[model samples]
Target: GGIITQTPKFLIGQEGQKLTLKCQQNFNHDTMYWYRQDSGKGLRLIYYSITENDLQKGDLSEGYDASREKKSSFSLTVTSAQKNEMAVFLCASSMAKQDTQYFGPGTRLLVL
Candidate 1:
């Protein structure tokens, strides 16, 4: 069994601020992902990394940046925060892109 950890469980930011979220896993998986969830909507892919130092942009990647510093850690940055909004960011990992993914506890963000 493995576990995923997301840091700073809660994030509060101001409009236009650049905020960062982080994830780490012990599964030794090769594929890691970052997803954003808006109220009443399904999860949206924001970024993914197939291996260390390799990053792939997803549908919502236009306003974000990601990094895979090592096989077990991945991070994401929101280029510009929107005011009076909230969202949940989830981190997941799988053995391969098409394999079952295990998710981490999400990081909740609130922009004030």
Candidate 2:
């Protein structure tokens, strides 16, 4: 019930190309989410799933994001395209709503 702001959102990949960011957690948490962070700002939620197949969109959920086929993993896809695919993709899981969240390492993409 609060406003989320993203200062200059990032694009992930070229137009019409699949860019997938995968996440896996071992704690078997019930809730998982994807977020992006900027050096000067705070974490911004992109998308999240409460359980296996339940998805909810965040402010930046313009692309495809999902809970994985297995409960231990989750995926955030800037799917079949974006003008530019760059953002710090952080995956976090919690045992219950707003409980302590354990975060996976942020993902960085490189293209030459």
Candidate 3:
């Protein structure tokens, strides 16, 4: 078994600030994903990478950027933070898109 680690745990930002969140996994999975969760809502996929240096934009990728520096790491950036907003950003890994995904502890963000 392996675990996924999300850095900083908490993030505070000002309106319009660009914030970055990071994730790393020891599972050595071939695919990694970034998802955003709003209160009372399901996760929305932001970005995913199938392998090192391979990037794919998801439904909610318009205001975000992602990078897969290596198979074990993925990172996401909020292009512009919105005021008085809060959300949890989750990281996940899977052997294939159809396979079950293992999630990391989320990074919570609050914008003031």
Candidate 4:
């Protein structure tokens, strides 16, 4: 299968700079999502896409950018990396309310 979820284990974000994280899934799922988790807190939805080229903002979507141009790919970008924004970014895919989502290993963002 061409299904693989990968990103740099750790991304160093320069202050006030834009940081991008990439994710790819080949599960043929129709929905892809992005979430942010702080040190000891719960995961908060950042963004989600129901189909190719369709983007929906989630509760914590401010200060972030996301794209879903292809069925198997999606990208998330932090508009402005800040010192207080260090967190884990998680990506997942599912069949839009029909199946459980499969989450990819999280990518840590270390804003310096």
Candidate 5:
């Protein structure tokens, strides 16, 4: 049994500002991922890390940066936030690339 936690449940940022969100997990999973969910929209992959110090950019990684500073933590930064770009950032983990993934509650971001 394990749990994942995301900090700053709500984030308010200015347009074009760089905002960061953090996630932590204790599941000892090998794969961690960051996804963005727009209002009423499906999940879009931002970035993923297979292991500590290993980074993989996903389909939607153009405006985001991700880090796997340690096995238990992953962080994401929005390079340049856009107006009306409110979305929820979700963190997920999987034992393997093709395994079922567990997701965090998500961090809501509102760009003003």
Candidate 6:
């Protein structure tokens, strides 16, 4: 059994600033993903990595970048912080696209 941890549980950023978020998993899964959950919206994919050094952009990847440094870690960087309300960013991992995914608690970010 393994765990996933996200750094800086709460992130405060200025408008137009670029912020980076980190995620580390010990599950050694084959796939990792970054997702954004807005105030009143469902989860939207930002990016995903199928393996080490692989990056795939998602529907919401316009404002974000992601990296899979190793089999156990995946990170994301926000290109530009917007004036949107608070939201939670979730990290997930799966054996494959068709397999069940496990999610991390989330990183809450607020743009002031």
Per-residue accuracy of model 4 over 8-93 as CA lDDT, tens digit each = 76899788999889999988888999999897889999999999999999999999999997989999999999985688899999
Residue pairs in clash, model 1: none
TM-scores for candidates 1 onward, in order: 0.97, 0.75, 0.96, 0.92, 0.96, 0.94
Clashing pairs in 6: none
Q: Which candidate model has the greater TM-score, 2 or 5?
A: 5
Please estimate how well model 5 matches the true structure, expressed as its whole-model Cα lDDT. Answer: 0.94
Evaluate model 6: give its lDDT. Answer: 0.90
Clashes of each: 0, 5, 0, 0, 0, 0
In candidate 6, how many Å is residue 24 off? Answer: 0.6
Instruction: Give me the overall lDDT of model 3.
Output: 0.95
Q: Which rank order by lDDT, best down to worst?
A: 1, 3, 5, 6, 4, 2
Compared with the true structure, what per-residue lDDT tens digits does model 2 show for residues 1-112? 1111221233335567767777777787888888877666689898888888788898877766565566666777766554544457678888889798877767764322
Q: Quote the lDDT for 53 in model 2.
A: 78
Find the 10 residues in a row with the least total lDDT in model 3: 36-45
**What is candidate 5's lDDT per residue for 1-112, written digit by digit as tens?**
8999998899999999999999999999999999999867799999999999999999899989999999999999999999978889999999889999999999999999
Candidate 4's C-alpha runs over 4 A off are 1-4
What are the per-residue Cα lDDT tens digits for candidate 1 across 1-112? 9999998799999999999899999999999999999988899999999999999989999889999999999999999998997999999999997899999999999999
Q: Tens digit of lDDT per residue, candidate 3, span 1-112?
A: 9999998799999999999999999998999999999978899999999999999999999989999999999999999999998999999999887988999999999999
Q: What is each predicted model's overall lDDT from 0 to 1?
A: 0.95, 0.68, 0.95, 0.89, 0.94, 0.90
As a TM-score, model 6 comes out at 0.94
The positional error of residue 67 in candidate 3, measured at the CA in angstroms, is: 0.5
RMSD of each: 0.7, 7.5, 0.8, 1.5, 0.9, 1.1
Q: Write the per-residue lDDT of candidate 6 for residues 10-109, one digit (tens) a residue.
A: 9999999989899988887899999999867899999999989999989989978887889888999988898864899999998888898899889999
